[model samples]
Target: MHLVYHNLRRRLLKYTWFLKFLAFLLLVSTAIFLVFKIVPLLLKFPVQLVNFLKPPQSVLRTTSGRTNFILLGMGGAGHEAPDLTDTIIFASLNPQTQDIVLISIPRDLWIPSLRAKINTTYYYGEQKQLGGGLILTKASIEEVLGQPVHYGLAINFTGFTRAIDLVGGIDITIPQTFDDFKYPIPGQEAAIPEANRYEHVHFDAGPQHLDGATALKYVRSRNAEGDQGTDFARQARQQQVLTAFKDKLFSTQTLLNPNRLLDLKQTFSAALIHDLSDAEILALVKTAFFNPPNLRSGILDTATSSGLLTHPPVSARYDYQWTLIPQDDHQLKDYVRQLLFGQ
Candidate 1:
């Protein structure tokens, strides 16, 4: 009886070990299915998942249930003010609701802490330490917007153009016919003849396909005639191009093609600057994948009816330079808060 009892105990222990092994295999298989099969299918045919699927809250860093990122676009080498962050957009995503809000901060906005234009913060930060540009930029934006910034990404012209080209270009619709005769040719800013420095670019009001260079011009054209010449209009155009590029990037062709995705990764890796870890980056991609179609975008310009900000008159206080300042600090914060929280 004693021998039989000992033999039965040993068999029970063996059964327990087998059960553990099976559980381990099941966990791994589930992870693989989610990553390899489900994710790719969702990318190929993205549905309105926000209605049914809410992202796990612990996936990324967030403040007040909103994850915020600052996107900085620089002119890059060979262009004047290569380090200046001409395009500053504060993008906030609500994983619970999959709502995205894009707020364009003008480069000419003043930063009292740096005693300079907001655009110069990144440049000075880089001078102080490596990878400090994004840090400083994020801090400055947080101060102005009254929100915590979780991450920052800085992309130059090269990366912008190359990424678009890698995906075989993007499709954009010109909302209105416009002409930009002063589109400065790269590396020719100081050329002898001013006439030779800029080449004329025109687009009709209709659907159009744009290559890398032309798309760059479409977003960077700040000297177009009439309403299109305004910085506000340029900001709108930039957002439109960004939406188009994002759609192209996640389209079935791009998502399913391994070679194209690899090439894009290589190109972006060379030209992009960010402080995101591998896991954090994946989390953001997942957030975007499950996001809804609702996108709210606005530019904080003094000309807007909202009047959240005002153009302070040129004075020695601003070094005799034009800059935008909030009309009411409290109101500005409230405006941003409403955009993010709808409260």
Candidate 2:
């Protein structure tokens, strides 16, 4: 009877081991399936879209091992007009530290002989000038900041709105109540009639939800608050939108959702123009998401006194000036270097 009991115990132990082995195999198979089948299919959307839009360019090999880019917004003429760049922002990322910095350049900031607004750089390039808009803009910015602009991505205003919507609109806080005169919609030659243009898109200064169109209005609206109706106000709004965007993009659900990824790729595919290779972009994306760095922002303070260039030709209501980087510009450059290089 004792011998019989021992044999039965050995049989039970063997059965338990077999069950454990099977369970381990199931878990391994699931993980492999996700990495090989699921992730590849989902990531392909952005990869293909990016390829279609910019294609890849040969980039200079770098030992600094840091990735940097410029995010440009062009407010070209007409709905289909392609002229100068309306906005230029330098964005830098440090893979090791995951820090980011965005610096905005005023389109009208005075550059020698180039009374032409910054956005006009693209127009100048398109005119078959010696250098294209991107080249001219990069030269101007590099002269001002004393650094190399490794790569740049340009987005149209419409594309910006579409991308925002694709990502599921962003949330922002209104600082005050204000009015936004209706501006002509792209492709519509007739000015939005003055009467129809004066829509009161007002919101109390506080936390609120904003859709893509409304958020565009919020950032582009200069007269929303009586006290805030200048380029400075616009810059602040731009920064706010950017921060909100980063937050949304980094959200786990947004990053992980295959549908959202595809939508994002499709929405911005036509609008985005970049000069980075697929490998570089993938590396940068991985670094940004896996190891994020602190983000910092600041504006250039010019010598021109307030209200000096209150009324410029194109948009009389807008302000302009011959802005100069402060004498202590090195401080700003150092901050940027630290953010980008993680040194």
Which prediction has the highest TM-score against the true structure?
1
Q: Write the per-residue lDDT of candidate 1 for residues 34-106, one digit (tens) a residue.
A: 4554566556654523311435456578889988888777878878889998678777878777776766677
lDDT of each: 0.69, 0.52
> Over the stretch 1-343, how does candidate 2's per-residue lDDT look in tens digits?
0000011112222221112211222222233334444457447777544432331222323326544555566654355455566556655544555555555555655444465555566677658664365666666666545567777666666666765676678888877666655443455444455454345666667898777787777776756446656766765676677668657766776768777766665555565666665455544444433444465544433333432222225432223443332334455455445545555
Candidate 2 Cα RMSD (Å)? 19.5
Residue pairs with clashing backbones, model 1: none
The predictions' CA RMSDs to the true structure, in order, are 18.0, 19.5
TM-score of each: 0.74, 0.61
Regions more than 4 Å wrong, model 1? 1-56, 170-179, 202-209, 225-253, 290-294
TM-score of 2: 0.61
